[model samples]
Target: MSFRESVATATVSRSVHFFPLHLRRDLVRQAAEDLDRYHGKAAADYWRSTCRGLAADLTAKGCSDDEMREQIMDFQAAVQVALLEMHREQLAQG
Candidate 1:
């Protein structure tokens, strides 16, 4: 099934909601770092796509537009912070 289709059917997937809050946050950060490593210059585009997907999912789950926007902003900030920390570590190691 397509991502949108799946999200539309389930309020939250087990893969996501199964985890504790802290673990889920760590997973998000780790995913951002991994995507940056894999996508390099295209990582920003990928991240934006991820946030868009989040918005879609939130909408599917009946979130208000304002709630979706706030969540997306928070998600983007977390990803940016993760990427920045990884970059700083790489620089420090050089």
Candidate 2:
């Protein structure tokens, strides 16, 4: 399956029942933003590692892979927005 598909599936299966939908989305978005901030290939590796860790944790708690992915996506999105805001602030300061 494609990466997005896998993530979506994992999210649905693992996390949907635990968190409210909006919170889950926010968590995944934050994770994505953090992953994007790293230098070079490290960013990709960080995201992969983070996702794997999250998946494992969720599974241990009886969550499905789909839920884990969803949470990560939410975190990523939140991070992205925060990063953008920080950049803007920095620009304003300069």
**How much does each candidate deviate from the true structure in C-alpha RMSD?**
10.0, 11.6
* Model 2 TM-score on a 0 to 1 scale: 0.55
Give the lowest summed-lDDT range of ten residues in model 1.
14-23
Q: What lDDT tens digits, residue by residue, belong to model 1 across residues 1-94?
A: 9999998778564432212212357757876776777666587677667778877877787676776787777666776677788889989999
Q: Tens-digit lDDT track for model 2 on 17-81? A: 56532356555556646765797789878867876786677678776677767866665566667
The TM-scores, one per candidate, come to 0.60, 0.55
CA lDDT scores, all candidates in order: 0.68, 0.67
Q: Per-residue lDDT for 38 in model 2?
A: 92
State how far residue 23 of model 1 sits from its true place (Å): 8.6
